[model samples]
Target: MSAGQVIKCKAAVAWEPGKPLVIEDVEVAPPKVHEVRIKIVATGVCHTDWECLYGTGKGMKFRPFPLVLGHEAAGVVESVGPEVTKFSPGDKVIPLFLPQCGECDRCQSPKTNLCKKNWANTQVGVLADGTSRISCKGQQVYQFLGVSSFSQYTVVPDTSLAKIKSDAPLDKVCLLGCGVSTGYGAAIKTAKVEKDSSCAVFGLGAVGLAAVMGCQAAGAKTIIGVDINPNKFAKARVFGTTECINPRDHPNKTIQEVLVEKTCGGVDYALECVGSPVIMTAALESTTDAWGTCVIAGWSETEAMNVVVEKILMGRTLKGTYFGGWKSVQDVPKLVDDYMKNKLKLDEFITHKLKLDQVNEAFDLLKSGESIRTVISLF
Candidate 1:
């Protein structure tokens, strides 16, 4: 503890969801062991952030009031904890939405993207050791998803920080932390998309388009983008979507029919990026018979929607994917490199940018579906 350790900053606090975001000065503490202080350069306004604010009709869980909410972000390391080894002040870094220690058993396992050791710490919105690292006005506050980039500065474990090339644009590359990684990983890693395979992504938002890019990367010859909004087709095409189908155009028949004709009896893999049960149903129904894989990439309240089990009799499999079934430290840096090399379409994903004060405006645009992605530029 140092005599001049006191610090103050601004953040968007969710005292209550469905209410306006509370922007006010907040206090932050110094980094603890294995932790690093990050000056958030940019953070993406994701649907999951909104869900965390307004509990999904399915009863989404979150910590009590005064939580700094954000997950996908990129920035510069402002300070480092006593035991941090891989990073230091001035290092360019992206805060992973999910933290993973490279030495953990789950990090070694292929089936799970989650690192088991951090479970208890993440659940309580504190450090893995059950200590509060952030406080506001002397009252302890919870860090949303470990890296709460909604604030100007936040602390995260060294394992949660992915150092990237200093030359990479933090605003564009920030999406890779969560949305891009989650969607692309679901398609390539979880679904293990085969070359020339047929796939359909049911949502053309940031994550959905990332899925489209993932499909293209995986060598899927026929990639179908499904969304009710016709405007999304333009953006979907940029990500290598060969076919864009509007569910409204086929009003008489279900989306499954359109996908069947376009993909030849549905698709070999279906990625559900929209949280609605209707879209979930469409995702399952659009799977190919005998061996189709349907991956749920959206966040929704479990109690709000009923799982229709009858459609899965054809040997279709439905699974949930988090952080793209990836170990953050290993996968994120590679994705950043791909973005830098022009192998990935990150610019296509960012449609807007705002500062900390404009966060609510970003949310308004998000609610209107007017943008593919909105970034809050803290730098």
Candidate 2:
């Protein structure tokens, strides 16, 4: 394929909410100004993608259907749009749903990682130009997030990709695009977990395990894993959870109460990877009253929470992270380097691997909570 030429490829598109994705041949238009076209090799299926496809949260349901829904992916730059100077063909890259347009005020600030470029608009299913580049059966298929790695080829703004080392494995490092980055950064950057501090990560999925890894890497001495599923305990231990607690095991006391008692007060850090508002509240209450920190790493639902103001009044900190509080273009490549250096683990997060045609089966595994992450090999 050449510049300004349309490319034809296969894509897994979800035509309706709560439905399986269909393998369809799609037409990918050439990237416009400041956009880059990528040929995705491998993509990781995440809970957010499943939520978008299942249409559970209002967060992702707003994106129109007949959509390509995979955000955590690694690919090679196939072409660059006019006036795009940062990337070229053959550069190994990871598409970032959270873009970093250097021109924005937030991009210039050190206090925040959000770029006010085209985020709000992209969530509505269009790119910077208020249009989509993917089409199937002569109909427009909205892109999922900005990555849409479920497709063989996708076009995203140049600001929405991070260039990685050429020798890195796309199949493995693809995870750094979402879950790994989100969770690991949640503990390392957002929580700033200190050495000898105590941490409780609620949820044992790939993101939670990544958080566990982050806590361990940050030198936290007491890392506790909390989940209802005991089956995840073994896997969580491998990721550095010193103790695993099944909430159901303590029937009489609240999970937060159990955590407070176990820590002799409350944990120094509580990270919630579960999206439920109740769990969010519990995680906050599980923190040390004087100097406890709670970070909501999960994308929460629209439901209102009845938070006790006393939780914050006692010097407790409650906050949340967007993309793990890391600037996408700047930090993602460093994470890739970490993976390359063996300082991070991505292979363990992938529980299953399947072809593009098995995309529905991947979703089924996700629905059953039997897989941490299912990687789809687009080749």
Candidate 3:
């Protein structure tokens, strides 16, 4: 049996920042206590992976080198470590970067999805035990955000994965691991979008489209999509965007002003999928001053931004979400079921399909805005 033994596998390794990931033979150690080894089936190329790849994840901060970067992926449980009673071999699962440990205070609370056992106590790139489980050419390789789905074989804590239905397609439901879940939940859960309410979504990326889809599902009447790129407008419409706006169309008026004018004051809800502080400000201002909610669903490289306090003083609410405010272990499975039942859209998000060898090309497509969600089939 492969249990208790190291597994040699192929993975896209980020040896250094600002360089393409090199396909390397990596040795993945067997799972430790309460951990599970995963045989990745299909993984989605997310923009966060790109952000982290360039060492610009949070802000202008440098990260450890030789890391495996990826979080959104679906796989089968290869082996279960000691005390891992929840999952077993052959179980279909999705690796979650935002883990939901059961006994944590945040996990018990209904207000936030951020967990306390999020490994802040440990080193930046190591597991909970204070060391990495991945190595390459006799050198240590760091795990990226705990999941490291770019690797062919990976180990994650029991709380770091969600078990999905057997019939759910790994290729499609993998989107739920990150982008889809983040965007959809931003609108449905965080923003608590009301039925027949007017909404505006910024960015028109995968997450933005997912938010639009969520608004549609919630019975939104007028959904406007805002983006700099006009190419994404058509796809935004398919995801229930009632109209589209390009910031370049109106040079004189600010984005928020344009949105406010369009909605005859402001939209009832606004979702920012782009991680720009400027866009976040626009999203906040483009909401109805009376009880309008703006959810920041994007990751910004700029650490902080100045906002108009009068906007909030006028009774508008501004909120932020990590991983779409989802309790990952519990809700991800339900999302997969939703996709399986055709209640959620997954196919439209997938613009390209490629093999593991073409991973750099996939990232290139993502970088150039040529593809939405590219599924890299490893099998």
Candidate 4:
């Protein structure tokens, strides 16, 4: 617990692709310059983590193995290195997988939330220093998404830390780190959904549900939830989905056809929460002609997202977002505050909670489409 001192702790390490994680003792090197060490209290299992583990996508197949893989996490700062002025010991914070270097052009521009400088290091699973902070039995373990909350303890750049209120429940607010924020922001920020407008959301996972909640918050009159699984409809309703449609029920008709017919042409806004190229195309096609806006919130690692050029030519806008278009360090704290005030629904998103030992089981729940968000308690 002092600066520059290594600490040994438990971490769920992914040894290889398509393999269960192993809870092993990991040596976490103390904060280097401008870095802060955190004791992870809770983390959420995200689909992106699962994709990183088993996805055969271009960059995903080549990801460095023996990596620690949880990103949506909330923790208390245990130590801070030299030149770290933003946070101190005992401060509650969420580690941002997307760090915000305010000096970057992307950070300075109002049009984007992506910080251009720190993002390159995330591709290689190294820190800003171009090295790993975790080691197991003298072998290096790469960090995942820069946050790497799978470990009981993690070290991140000071710029990556989003300090929140001390009393905020780490277990619930941890969802704000990714899913909740990404989904909710896709509606409120990216799409800027208008009041009483019709909206269609594809997929019913945590991110999709959050998108539903966001559309409701924006006062959308007709919020339609589209998913292949009927079981997800009940929970999707609780999150403000006014109508539910299962593609399985309409086998004769395409999902986009059903949605467009149901909405009397097409919806005002269409949000694609599923990372499928087919669904991405359908989402675009399901929107109202001339004015419909389609926001791609899901992260699709595969190469081409083919859509008819005529779709855009007809005045339908296709846009993509990262982290829901919210600047992480600047906006995540406010989201935590919104959750505390009951303006945001965090508890409803958490369908299961498990201990660190059940990390693989959490992934199973996600893969089986049985849980909305499974929070892993590291404490």
Candidate 5:
């Protein structure tokens, strides 16, 4: 494989909104300047990818049809375009949807991880050159989040890639690209969870479970997992949850009220990973009044969050995190290194694995809450 060459490979394409992905042979063009082509080995099925396939109320803001949907992935560098010097063929890497362009204002800031240059292109679903490298049956296909790892081969900007150690397993590190990092970073980075403090995670999905792991790693004495599904509690405990609460169990009381009562006032930290504005509000209100911090790590399509004026006035801090507040170029590789050292848990998050042809069934597993993370094995 070389630059400017067209490679035919199998990919899951979204022909229309609210429809199952079609597995077809798509043409992946060679990388252009400052871009690299990757042979994706594995990709995790994330909620963001699912929401993009099924149109959100925001109306195609993210659900661009005829797009190759997927972002959280790990693969090998197949080829590099002109002017590319950092990576070469055979290098293992992960595609970062939230790229780290060091020259951008956000990248330079220590407080944020978002890159301005790549963030702008994220909305258009195209490469930095304002064009796509995927096509099928003579029709152009848009790249989702620039990576589009649902395809066997894809082109990505050099800045949007994180080279990892060769020994790292692609099937496992792929989860760190998004959900795990987002949830873990929300606890250790955004909220700065403290030792002996209490924390609450308001979802049992992969991201929420990662948050639980983060709190435990931070030495939090009491970790509470809240979800409507009780089946998830066992899995949550595997990640270090001290207690589990099903909101449905307390039908007469709000989740916030139950949380407040259980923690004696409220938890020192609350994380909303479900992406519902309702849950976001509850997480905030459930935090201890005079210093508790709440982090919103979920994505909501159309929900508008409403917070009481006094909530912030009383000293509660509310923050939003993207990609776990991690600098992809710098931090993702370190996360992989952490996993290699057994300091982070990745294998436990994967509840099911399927081939690319079973991609639709992966989504069904996620929707039914039967799996923590469904990995699509491209190889």
Candidate 6:
């Protein structure tokens, strides 16, 4: 690959959310130093993509309109940046939206999910070095979540690319890149769920299902799932949820009381997977009287909550997680291995596989509760 090589390909552009994913021809530039080009196999359409589409009350930091939308994905490395050391052409890789510069203090620390310095550019939806590698009709199109796997090909930082075994199906493993990792990490890593513990998850989307699976793997004896959609219960149970609640069924019931009754007390851990502030309140209030942990794992723009702070006065801790508090460099591959070993349920989470042209339909299914995950099969 040379400097001026322009690889023309198809991409799903998000001119607006409710509008369809505009399909157009785009130019993917050759990889720069420390970057790699991937022929995307599949990309998972997640709620984060939806949020990025319709600016969730919290204004998007990434600039407006005429942008490619998507993040969660897996693919094969087609080329490498000049200085890239860890990967080569033909390697199977999963793109991490939050790239990590291994030498950064935050990456060195066990607590944070991101490498502060490496992400300065990705936050703006450009390449890490300050410019974009993808453009359309000569205009620099915004790269949503850095990877922009909505395209037939995507260029990502080497640090953002994790090499996985080629044997694993790209479609299933791609979900692990984002929602699965976020939800699983929220329960297994951030919350540090204990065996036989009582846990309640406040959403039943893909991430919520991943959390439920993580809670089960961590040996949680009681797993309660809360969701607005009653249809998610069957799927949640397959992911290890022991009980399910539809908010509609408890119209007059308080979230706290309902959870208390379900768990025989408050839950040992409560996970808020929905971005709503009201749900966050419910998560906090649903925890056990003391030594309970409430984890806010939802990607939301809501800031204020109707909270009674006293509910958490009894040694209950409110925690927030980013990518499940996972260190991508370490955890991503482990997740893949777990999936391959059948230790984690990956297949159950996927509800649809779509082509780039059908990307917007994927979002519609997500919003209408018609699908748990919609994967864009670029291959």
TM-score per model over all chains = 0.94, 0.98, 0.97, 0.98, 0.98, 0.96
Q: How close is candidate 6 to the true structure, as a TM-score?
A: 0.96
Q: What TM-score would you give candidate 2 relative to the actual structure?
A: 0.98
User: Tens-digit lDDT track for model 2 on 1-379?
Assistant: 4668999999998898888889999999999999999999999988888888775565544568788999999999999999999999999999999999887889999888989678876887779888889999999888887668999999999999999999999999999999999999999999999999999999999889999999999999999999988888888998999999999989999999999999999999999997778899999999999899999988755665568988899999998988889999999999999988899989988899999999989889987878989999999
Better of 1 and 2 by lDDT: 2
lDDT of each: 0.83, 0.90, 0.90, 0.92, 0.92, 0.85
> Candidate 6 — which residues are off by over 4 angstroms?
1-4, 16-18, 56-62
Write down the lDDT that model 1 would get. 0.83
The residue-by-residue lDDT of candidate 6 on 291-379, one tens digit each, is 88999988764467776767767789998898888888677888899899989888898899888888878888999999999888885
Please count the clashing residue pairs in each candidate, in the order shown: 1, 0, 0, 0, 0, 0
lDDT string, candidate 5, 1-379, tens digits: 3556899999999998888999999999999999999999999999888888774565235446689998999999999999999999999999999888789778889989888665666566788888888999999898998889899999999999999999999999999889999999999999899999999999999999999999999999999999999999999999999999999999999999999999999999999998888899999999999999999999875668989989999999999998889998999999999999999999999999999999999999999999899999997
Supply candidate 3's per-residue lDDT for 31.
92
| CA RMSD (A), model 3 | 1.4
**Best of the two (3, 5) by TM-score:** 5
Candidate 3 Cα outliers beyond 4 Å, as residue runs: 55-60, 121-123
- Which residue pairs in candidate 5 collide? none
List the lowest-lDDT window of 10 residues for candidate 5: 55-64
What's model 2's overall lDDT?
A: 0.90
